[model samples]
Target: MVDKSARTPAETKDAGVLIVGLGRFGSSMALTLDRLGQDVLAVERSPGLVAHYSDRFPIVEADASNPEALEQLGAREFSVAVVGVGTSLEASVLITGNLVDMGTPQIWAKAISAEHGRILQRIGAHHVVFPEADAGNRVAHLVSGKLLDYIEVEDGFTIVKMRPPRETQGFTIEQTKVRERYGVTIIGVKSPGQEFVYAEPTTRISSNDLIVVSGHSELLERFAARP
Candidate 1:
């Protein structure tokens, strides 16, 4: 393991995150966390991956499936750890179990399928992510030609960007009564050449305007599907 620097135990415990595996999912997480200014220590079993990212991140070539390797690298110092090994279910489970045994406060594991997610949760993973599955679902929603973008904030709630329907165009928000009729809230609007602005009760919608709306997933889908 490569020691980046000397840090107090409290600082390490409070701020750092340990990320195991450097495949597509793991690498993406590391890059995003780094961009967000979070302190990250990455571990990958492949020497090539470790070398490719070492100059950009604090990474080490280590098999995190082995508890001993994690112990030697002081994995317990991290308050949160992410197991991004999706290719091998066995390796993924082993790493997650190791982190749980070490009493990591928050564990996020990637799951390739529903069963894999269940096992991770049963083994004490605090959060289970299905990146590929979620991406596919999002794309499926976008392909309908109405919703430009869709994000499910939770089980039922969603926020979407879409073109204003004909009924909404050429009318102010208050005039359209969209919220009253459609059960969705227009949070913002973007004109053809202007920056996105917060939606107001009197904000007028044009045929070319883009709107951001938030509501239950079903309601948002219905609103977007409107002509």
Candidate 2:
């Protein structure tokens, strides 16, 4: 661990999301959350960066690894906090430890390596994200023509949008019995030249139609890959 002096200037405001670090990932997360009407408090070690983003949202110039600074900012009270110091593994780990010690309910951290991710989780970070790996997976999924869009709603289940394969065209929902046959649920459908409709027993599926389905990822992939 890198040793750094503690500094805690008085602060008066609280935020729904506490963002530590001002790197690309942190700044983007802070800005996007603020734009989405979330109360966001961003912390940065560099005064220059704090000044750079101050015009957009509330920013604090402080070292996230300093426990005093974190406490002064009421870090323990925030429901969610994200540690975005992947470039400096030491800093990331230190900040994650501080957040965990402060009892931040949910801590999401960015990690540059698998070992770094494991360390964050061991220190109680509720979630860890490898942005590069995640983006690569998304690109691979798209390139492989698996689906038009994919979003994992939870650990094992996902929601995906894709055009029906030629084999399933002209089949009614009841005839397909997707839920029973493929272990996936067709939640919604977009017919040719028409807006999307919720899936129903009588709804007819065509090759050109886009379907939105939700199920275990493996099952969904199997269903999508059928010849």
Candidate 3:
């Protein structure tokens, strides 16, 4: 894992955010920022949404993917920029790259997936948003059967407590270092009458037991798919 450096200081004196793409995400985020008393400039290719939110937001009707349009909007003067284009990956890439090149104080982009997110990261996106995948997990967990628990965390990680596999039952915890392999840590566990205790490397998990785990977004899928 690359060592993340401390975040740069927020531009307290700079003007409010400049958002590209007036789709659902752009309008929604712009509205929120406007409500927060920040000056918000929204750019949109859609004339419909532009008219819809122009009165409520400071909007510039233009194709966000165009660097010339961004320059016309004076986006370089904003404290932050959000590229919220969905569907068009090429447009998203171009707009985000232009925003970074323009030296927008901060650039936030909505990514389609982990792989796509990596590409954006390489191109200078300050952060990747995965709202759908995250909300899906929380919604799916509500309909779960027998699974004790699950919770979502920042950057789309999950915490789960579920039963161990029958094949792995009776084996000492040390025999299988799940934490090392799965990139998740077992936080705690409960086995019927046994007292619920936080998990340790030496803690043996039995068959038909509940194991609390914390892991990355894909880690939860691995556990749920386990036979």
Candidate 4:
């Protein structure tokens, strides 16, 4: 077991994240949080994985599915915990339940299926994410060829990056009246060989310009589908 007190007072105060498992999802989450300057403690059962990432972040070899192991590592003190062991449903559920029993203020668990997600919610996971499913949905939208990139901010709302439609080519944003006509707002525009610029009334659209627009999902899809 690794010493939890190895972190200094300042690091401990900011290190409220406890992540279990070192699979793809867990590693990605740790890397992103680290990049954002968030302190993280990762627990994994695989010695190889622990060794691989030990230099990158603080990681210990332990099985989080065992509640005793979690307590030994001071899991209760963490304000946030993530159960990223989705390969085994039993292990995932057990870890989530342990976090809940420990009164973790925020518990995020990964679910492979709808049934798994419902189970996690029933057991008190504060948040459940279906990374594979969400990624598939996003890719489906991109494969349509209309949207260069898509982000669904919430139900029925989305922000998309797409090529300017032919009708808007060579026309100023104010003159095109895209907002008035499509009920979507162009947030920014990126012309080739230049940085992205915030959209303005006087900003003109070019045939090759890429635009970022935000609106209801259906409206944005219709706008992007323009000929």
lDDT of 3 by residue, 84-153 (tens): 8867889989999998888776889987788878878899988878667766877787466435666777
Candidate 3 vs candidate 4: the lDDT winner is 4
**lDDT digits (tens) for residues 40-146 of candidate 4:** 88999987888889888888788888999888777877899988999999999999999999898999999999999999999999999999998998899999868
Error of 4 at 3 (Å): 7.0
TM-score of 2: 0.86
RMSD of 1: 2.0
Estimate the lDDT of model 2.
0.83
Candidate RMSDs in order: 2.0, 4.5, 9.4, 2.3
Query: Best to worst by lDDT, what's the order?
Result: 1, 4, 2, 3
Model 2: residue 131 alpha-carbon error in angstroms: 2.0
| TM-scores, one per candidate | 0.92, 0.86, 0.60, 0.89
Which candidate leads in TM-score?
A: 1
What is the clash count for each candidate, in the order shown? 0, 0, 0, 0
Off by over 4 Å in 4: 3-11
Cα lDDT listed for each candidate: 0.90, 0.83, 0.73, 0.89
Score residue 134 of candidate 3 by CA lDDT.
62
Better of 1 and 3 by TM-score: 1
